[model samples]
Target: MAEHRRLFFALWPDEALRQQIAAISATADWPRGARRVPAAHLHLTLVFLGDVPAERVDAVRSVAASLRVAPFELSLAGCGHFPRAEVGWLGCVDAPPALFALNTGLRQRLRTQGFALRGESFRPHVTLARGLREPPVLPDYPPLHWPVSEYVLVESRRGRAPAYTVIGAWSLAPVSD
Candidate 1:
């Protein structure tokens, strides 16, 4: 039997922003067979819990459900590459402290629940292209800001292209309320 692996949790980008990012990626001369993530799938990943067994999904969800951080506005600015020329991604110029705190708390909670920590330090980014060689110089796009109120746990499948399936989502109540 193929093992069912649980994926990561992230805040999805809005439709307009997704379209804008897609447009930027489309103009880049990506290498052959390099797949661009679909606009609908653009998101800021919070935690990547790779390869959890199907039976453990509920436990992960319970941990996520206990997260207490309130909704906050995240602004996306600037473009950058990852692992050198191999990958390209979009990033927030200024990540609010709340974002960092939330990530740290989630990491701790998931660790207590027995999830493995990603080896690299959390440099939060939304990936645009995989297998990129020479990234194109992009014009400055206007900064994008959005209120993030929820996070979703997604399942990924590798095929001709990488695809994500939402396994569960948890909402964060507004702090002001």
Candidate 2:
């Protein structure tokens, strides 16, 4: 039997944009127990598939590669904590329609291929930090602009500090000027 891989779909920013987004973490005072996510690990998850068997990886890859979306812009702004989940996240003030369609397309294909995702609602956010003891007052900040061109399938390997590796990426159609 093939080993299962913890997998998810994410919108990863280019290094420069990633740095811009990561800087937002420094501006806030998190609640006790908060652990800020490292700069390299910052990404907005499109859909999280907890685990998939080794044999099914190709099927997942095919589904990802088949998706069709035009490139769109993403605006990350504002930071807040989910009091219950203790996750402090940064998110877009205006999530574009293309983002929603891309998400739905991936979910539909995955479901047909026998992968069931855990969550019912899809809220677009990049988790900045976690383990918040209490929700702090959120702050308003200028939007961090990131152009969404492609999304990747990431594998999370367990270790002292879990490592996330991009296994595959699919590009969206480029918009004509």
Instruction: Itemize residue pairs with steric clashes in candidate 1.
Output: none
Write one digit per residue (lDDT tens) for candidate 2, span 1-177. Answer: 668999999999899988876666777777777888899899999999888998899999999988888999988887777778789888787899999988999999999999988877888989888888676545566888888989999998887797999999999995456
Q: All candidates' TM-scores?
A: 0.88, 0.93
Steric collisions counted per model: 0, 0
Tens digits of per-residue lDDT for model 1 on 49-138?
A: 888888888888898888887788877777777756466787886888778867887899989998887855777777887776756455
Candidate 1 lDDT at 29 equals 60
Model 1 TM-score is 0.88
